[model samples]
Target: MDFSDLGKLKDLMGNAKLMQEQMEHRLSETVVEATSGGGIVTVRMNGRKEVLRLRISPTAMGSTGSDLELLEDLITAAVNEAGRRADEAMKSSMQGMMGGLDLPGLT
Candidate 1:
């Protein structure tokens, strides 16, 4: 193999190791919080996309006229918000690890 090919292989291996470490760190350290129904419902999620906690306000439960609709809307909103937060966190963490380097087929 040429020296240049050997060098490229070394770099690729280094990048793979870096990416693995970064992914693990991100999974363990990142958490995102989201709220819906004007903060009546709240959710917390980890970087691994696991739901950590959920909060529901008493006012949200006590709404009598359209309780089911309210509940559905609140759940949808909270879920969407959580997803948004997760996407943002993932992008930020990946960007930091990547150091502005572009890797096709990786993202």
Candidate 2:
């Protein structure tokens, strides 16, 4: 509409962009660790939902070949748990950063 309104809009967009950058940095820095199957399988994931590391205990390989299926299930469980944690952590972080600022098309 008016030039002053346009300037305010520009500022809002700039601030939003800055917040987006900061959130991305925070997400990259955030990490969560989880384990499953009595800690036989462990996974570390970031807020971006990327698995940074995975560990499997030697005990997962039982004497019987049937143990392989159990190991797979354990790994899946561990990864899913880590992903759930990352989602929660990121959501909390975003809420704090956003400070209830529900901008149009941003929420």
Candidate 3:
């Protein structure tokens, strides 16, 4: 390739690296929350997909054995939803960084 083309490629690579670093920082800072079972279970997560906190309503905890299984299900649903939200947040941030540039083979 021509020198100009090589220089442009290098610059693109550098920008990509910077974007990646910025994304990492943003993911660490961004937070998302999800709830399940009429908000009996709540989960908080960051864009990095790390769970920050989980909260269960006392009413969700019943003395019945079946209640334990329901509680487990609610917790699982809340956590999964939180993770999904985190993924979406990260994807949106990445798209913003890309700034509408249509890269081949990349969403």
Q: Higher TM-score: candidate 1 or 2?
A: 2
Instruction: Give the alpha-carbon lDDT of every model.
Output: 0.84, 0.91, 0.91
Q: How accurate is candidate 3 locally (lDDT)?
A: 0.91
Compute the lDDT of residue 14 as modeled in candidate 2.
100
- Model 2: per-residue Cα lDDT over 1-107, one tens digit each: 99999999999999989988999998899999999988999999999999999999887778876798888889999999999999889888887888997756544
* Candidate 1 residue-wise lDDT, 1-107, digit = tens: 99999999999999899879879888767999999878999999888878888888877775476897888789778978997898788887788878887878444
Q: For each candidate, C-alpha RMSD in Å?
A: 2.5, 1.9, 1.6
Model 3: clashing residue pairs? none
Model 1 segments more than 4 A misplaced: 2-11, 63-65, 105-107
Shift in Å, residue 85, candidate 2: 0.3
Per-residue CA lDDT of model 3 for 1-107, tens digit only, reads: 99999999999899889988998899999999999999999999999889999999989978899999999999999999999999888877777888887877544
lDDT of 1: 0.84
Worst 10 residues of 3 by lDDT: 98-107
Colliding residue pairs in candidate 1: none
In terms of TM-score, how similar is model 2 to the real structure? 0.91
